[model samples]
Target: MITLDNVSKKYQTRDKGWFTAVEPTSLHINQGEIFGLMGYSGAGKSTLLRLINLLERPDTGKVLIDNQDLTAMSEAQLRQARQNIGMVFQQFNLLSNRTVAENVAFPLEIAGWDAAKIAQRVQECLEIVDLTERAQHYPAQLSGGQKQRVGIARALAPNPKVILA
Candidate 1:
């Protein structure tokens, strides 16, 4: 479970203007349930999500994940905790120069997985997204949906518990 209790974020401009991005917001998300944060651009949805991951610290209140306070964790602890959360952008950010397999292997490489494990995971992820046949194909060769599928596969390769869309 994830809980945001009276969380808020503020940005101070050079001109001494204070912008309140996320107000004192409180929310709860249950495990095994798909929760969504929806809004138009600049509605602070992204900021709220960032707060949950401690990508940006809240100015007030707390962010708790699975009953553990994420806001109180150290930077290293936050990084480790963030591993269980996956994020996908609206734009499919695949590397055009790399093959589908390579793109899927990127995250594993960042997490310091061995080459053999990377290869195995890439294969499994590709299969999960029904893109095994397109393993050697570059992003340019695939359709938009196919590219997004590759992104999803890459995000899931780490076995994240929470997916931030």
Candidate 2:
């Protein structure tokens, strides 16, 4: 489960002074449930999601995952914690220079998996997203939808306990 306790975020705009992106808000998301945030442009929807991943730090409160306080974790601890919390960005952030299989294998490689295991896991994830045929293709070689599929494959390669896609 994920919990946000009175979380908020603000930014200093170039001409508008301080802008509040997210106000003090609390939320709880249970395991195995699909939750979504919907809003018009500039409505803090993205900010709210970013806060859960600690990509945007909440100025007012705690971010907890499975009851552990993410806001209080050290940088190293946060990095380790991130391994189990997968995310697929709205922009589909695939590495341009890497092949689809390489992109999917990247996180597993960082986690210190052996080559054979990495290959096997990459194949498994690709099959899940039905991107197995495009595994050898580069990001530029695939269409936008295909790129998004690659992003999904990469996000699943870690076998995360919580996915933020």
lDDT of each: 0.87, 0.91
Candidate with maximal lDDT: 2
TM per candidate comes to 0.84, 0.96
What overall lDDT, based on C-alpha atoms, would model 1 receive against the true structure?
A: 0.87
Backbone clash total for model 1 is 0
Tens-digit lDDT track for model 1 on 1-165? 889999999999899999999999998989998888788899898888778888789999999888889889888898788788876656778888999999888878888899998889889888999999999999999999998998899888888888776
Model 1 residue 47 lDDT? Answer: 88
- Tell me the tens digit of each residue's lDDT in model 2 across 38-99: 88999998888899989988889999998889899998999999898988988998889999
Clashing pairs in 1: none
Q: For model 2, where is the 10-residue window of minimal lDDT?
A: 156-165
Which candidate number maximizes TM-score?
2
